[model samples]
Target chain A: MAMAAFRREGRRFAPLLHPNSITAPRSSLIPQELDPEGVRFISTQVVRNRMKSVKNIQKITKAMKMVAASKLRGVQTKAENSRGLWQPFTALLGDTPSIDVKKNVLVTISSDKGLCGGINSTSVKMSKAIHKLNSGPDKETKYVIVGEKAKAQLVRDSKKDIELNITDLQKIPLNYTQAIFLTLELVLVDKSSQAGLISVLADDILKNVEYDALRVVFNKFHSVVSFMPTMSTVLSPEVVEKEAEAGGRLEGLDSYEIEGGETKSEVLQNLTEFQFSSVLFNAVLENACSEMGARMSAMDSSSRNAGEMLDRLTLTYNRTRQASITTELIEIISGASALEG
Target chain B: MASNAAAVPFWRAAGMTYITYSNICANLVRNCLKEPYRSEAINREKVHFSVAKWVDGKPQKPRDEELWHGNHA
Candidate 1:
């Protein structure tokens, strides 16, 4: 009967009773290396420091997400505006046959910076697939890499295939003037054969300078949440001409006469140059939008992961603090009882 | 429109702006006309420093291909 009463009293006082393991040892004058109180103190300190660092990380990720979101709005508008001009332009070339030429060039468009998800990887993969399909003994496929991220990947697999690796394109927001200048530079490097082919009497000098075909690989932004890598093939002037002739658009041509002074070939050259600029500009715009979307999604996931960690750490911290307080209260109550006896 | 662009200087040619000329060039290329004529029509557009210059009579800048190979020469 007496023991049963004591057990009931102990249960009632359990909240105030400090667990003995947590209470510092009063009997021992010197603290041992394995002291329980010392271990708890060290653990609490470490956990607190860890929590603080995690909080800082969460703040950074959150800010990054906001920045990406704002940039996304501007790029999305630019992509849409370009699409308006590109649709009709593509339609004119839609019936054109793929050009058959000895050497083909593949331009891979990606951003120089990383921290975005798979934007770079997808561009590299698309280029590889096109490179594999086009590579043969009879014909050669040359790579013109536009960004560092894709260059890093392609250099390992197709080191010899890479004719030119261009970087620093993403230093500022892309503009039409930059696109035009880049097109001119590409024409200079790739059309190196034109000088030898040019003759004072030769009527076909312009035709000799044209590339057979160009394939541009880039990530296309489909929605706010997703991006798909795509390949756009642009045919040479010869093929485009053949397609238009075969499509029986001559009736349309018969109605309009060329200005008396302008010869037919001169007009064709300007059209080809303009088309080249528009196609390249479109690819760059689409790639920019995809990069922004990818970064936003990546930062969002990082912030979520940090939040989960903080929740778990806070739970542990609260439980440990409550247990320490109980241990101290029990130690005080036992001391008072001993003194009373 | 073709007759009008032919009569006047390119700048004074009413409705013969860069955009209109672009359409004309695009149409000519689509027809697949023979040789130097097709090539020459396209090169006629010469816009420098945002100013469209009459390149037909003026001394031309070195063509892109010429500049490229000329560097090595």
Candidate 2:
């Protein structure tokens, strides 16, 4: 036959092909069969190992959730207390008209730690969207990222625009001093003409933060389970003055005199600076609270998912064990019948 | 641009020395301090420097000596 002739010819021409033949011992292409008992044993070991690891992970996530929950209480109280100052001040500036500016500074507040679902990314996404809307030929938008995790994400989109990225802040609870120092640094970076000309503190820097309005984007904590990224704007005193002249909330301010013989402009400037820092502080605290809430929810879900996976794996393991036992019983019965025959 | 109404720098406006500003901020934080956070704010953490120079659009490590002395005299 033609097939026989082809095989003979192939063998004669390629004698080294014997190693790939079916009769060859331990050929790498062939899969060695596993006995039911062996299969069951391996599966049990694998499932046990997997279950143990998952249980450990579940424990870790549960602990983390509890920690975040406890921390949330303290952070929430701090944020609520500061609302007394921020609510009325922002109400006063509510009607201020937007100003046109060449440069705008956007401060995105987030936390360095992740494992919280979308907490950091929400701020980064909002920052990116705002930058996209505002970036133009005549306009330049600079970003001040508060968290390292967010900095890493936003850096990809706007490396140059990331004027400052503060990390290692999550180790401690955010305080007023941190907020003031951070605001001062932001003011310094936004200044185009000044470079080491002089050392400035809170007041001089506030003047230099010359945006028609300052915008802080952060995750606003809604409840123990919900948080959303929110944008809050702080209008400059200059803009507020203009708004006042145009019959805004401060229309009656001209009739009143500032205490201590301070000029109206002086008093307004101080108030504006105070409000700016206060707003920034509140945002930082709220973001901290949100981060904790997000972490708690995320870890809770993670723990639940792990539990589900463990259940499925255990069911599969039990089925595999039962199958192995059934196979052994059938083998024993067959052997006894063969002996009787 | 140089009007009498120009905004005075805070350090000049308040005539605050470096030590005074730190002391003031410390005292202010300590005044309204509550339990657990009180000790953390006052003892554990300290805000040493006021000004951080932004070099090439990044905050440089706040040079302690230069910040206090360079701004003073």
Candidate 3:
């Protein structure tokens, strides 16, 4: 990460070191080439200025590392707390019967910026692999990308069609409501359409149309140093139905029980929204946490590289200064001896 | 003292450029760890386990083995 920073700095600084800027003499004390003092002074000043700038950069990077670390800690806690909710939800899904549906949707979450390591690339590759595994030429495969980086990569490597491309979600509050809204807008447009009904009712909604299957591709945060790209499948309505038909009664299922003032369909709709919302929320949060972790690691490596460069440059500067002083001393001694002779 | 952001005119002047780069790198690592690397490893392990079942081989799950050896036995 530090390297990425350094490269960017180098690019920015390159233009500042133009011949016109560096070569123009600011002092009238001596000729440009013969005045070793002036040259040394200017060179040393430039080096010092550069070093100061780099030092400031290091400080900022360090602070950012700390911020990312704190955010990661908070996100991890949230993710853990939500796991309890996932258990009951998935259990309900398991109780549903399976059906034969023939479409797949993959919602991949990635980051907008680069330098965190291989997060975006990895996500794209995994999505491709999943697509390969689940989709045939005739099968309907669609994608809903969450981050800018993911969208760009998918677009570049697309051998199949993309159904939806969602960007700038980082600024939005990732919640169940947002998930429902997005799904409703993008995937659940036509109520009577097989794809729309299956997508809306199968995974999170109160088991409406049994979807063939639904999958989410995202990063799962493990620790500061470890994370993994994960693909989670929500049991489609068909699967639920099949399970229910095969001695798996839907009577006692969580979805079947209606709360006060809610019809069965209404309750199903709310649960559907909640389920979709949770999945989307989890994906976004996990991705954000992963981004922070990657940034931290990348910065750590960058700071180390900067330290190494500083060491080498300081050594070079010392040697050059020492050589110049030695030559001056030798010239002075020789002149004194000649005068005495 | 004036706030750093206010004092520094450009992003470079504020010395946030390095931070930006670091953030970028961190993002990359985070994404990579979550996506291809983690998924690939998990998928491979699943495939291996399936193959082991067919071949009558012992299924040595990494996490499970680590837990058993380090935490329990």
Candidate 4:
């Protein structure tokens, strides 16, 4: 078969980011390059240099893998805790599965760090698909890129659609404050289409950049090797209130007494914002965790491949070194024999 | 249900968005909680660093503004 054996093996054994790497590796030159004809001693030096470089690359990837693993451990707990915060709100809002959501902002959470395997691409791909599905003559879908990776990719195709893009989030550790600001930043971009207002802008489309709901696209961390791209829909409080009046799903909210100085609508809005912060917090944490997980796996494999390449190069170097030494010995012995004759 | 007595929330009447209302509520909730439990919750959840408004390709300097301003701080 014309296909490389590793292609089938990579598919069966490791269906991962290296699907592209399978096309052709440098080791394919082993047979042709090692051919004795026109072989020079300098070839040995070249192989040694490659072997040294591969060793260095392996060391870097191994260190990066360790870093990603530690980051994943640190972020996992926060993501879990934040998940609990949003559950109460979802119960209040009553997640009506079949409700058609139109005119919503798609907040895609992604890291610009290309080291994280295919996570950014996966999220961007899903966002594009959702945009295609939602955007039409009647409906509208605008993008609010939470991280720069999606912005970079989406800008190529959906330049006019991107309303806001925030970056520099993934390079540092994320906590509750960063997560909440990430949400609030959307509200701050007010009068002049500024960079500040996630909350205010979310109020309405006519005034600022407004939408009925927010479809948050992020990667949900499952484990070290598995992450699922997910979309969580958050509807505006007004929409939820309207739907509650018609659909009897929220009859339970009436049982509890909201005994604050503020009116019930004020309380509801507060709860909505509070609840959304939790969801946004959870999303950012989960996305970060998954990014680290993907990076860990990606770096681990890169390390392994580097090791394999080094081994092959070492073998070739030894063979070439020995071959050149033999050629020198043959030349000396034959010259002595010719002089004696 | 008191459908006849239904009144719009005061924050809405004041033209405040949910974000403002939530900030006010967070401040109030931190005030209502008792000691040890409150400290335990706040201390563990405290995030000290400030956030910079990311513009263009860089974060705006002098990011002195804290995203949250509540008793929890």
Leading candidate by TM-score: 2
lDDT over C-alpha atoms for residue B61 of model 3: 20
Task: Report DockQ per prediction, comma-separated.
Answer: 0.03, 0.17, 0.01, 0.13
Where model 3 places Cα greater than 4 Å from the true spot, the runs are A1-50, A94-101, A189-211, A243-273, B1-73
Per-residue lDDT of A196 in model 4 = 27
Model 2 vs truth, CA RMSD: 8.9
What DockQ does candidate 2 score? 0.17
Task: Label model 4 with its docking quality class.
Answer: incorrect
Model 2 residue A6 CA deviation in Å: 36
Which is better, 3 or 4, measured by DockQ?
4
Over A226-272, each residue of candidate 4 has an lDDT whose tens digit, in order, gives 99998877776676677766767766777678785655665665666
Write down the TM-score of every candidate. Answer: 0.65, 0.74, 0.59, 0.73
lDDT of each: 0.61, 0.65, 0.52, 0.67
- Candidate 2 lDDT at B19 equals 30
True contacts kept of each: 0.00, 0.03, 0.00, 0.08
Task: Tell me the lDDT of model 1 at A183.
Answer: 58
lDDT of 1 by residue, B1-73 (tens): 2324443446324323233244444545534656676554333322221101112222123232111111211
TM-score of predicted chain A against the true chain A, for each candidate: 0.75, 0.79, 0.70, 0.79
Chain A TM-score for model 4, please? Answer: 0.79
Off by over 4 Å in 2: A1-42, A95-99, A188-210, A249-257, B1-11, B14-41, B44-73
Query: Poorest 10 consecutive residues of model 2 chain A by lDDT?
Result: A28-37
Best by lDDT: 4
Model 3 C-alpha lDDT per residue in residues A1-341, reported as the tens digit of each score: 23323323433453566523433443322123332322322234444555666677777777777877787687677676666655676666542212224677677788877767777788888888887776666776566566668767877656244555555544433333334334443334233332232232233222122235556777778877778998766544444445555655554454465556533443343344455556666777777788889888877877777777667656655654555566557668999999999
Q: How do the residues A149-176 of candidate 1 rate in per-residue lDDT, one tens digit apiece?
A: 8868876767766665556665556655
Of candidate 4 chain A, the 10-residue stretch with the lowest lDDT total is A193-202
Name the DockQ score for candidate 4: 0.13
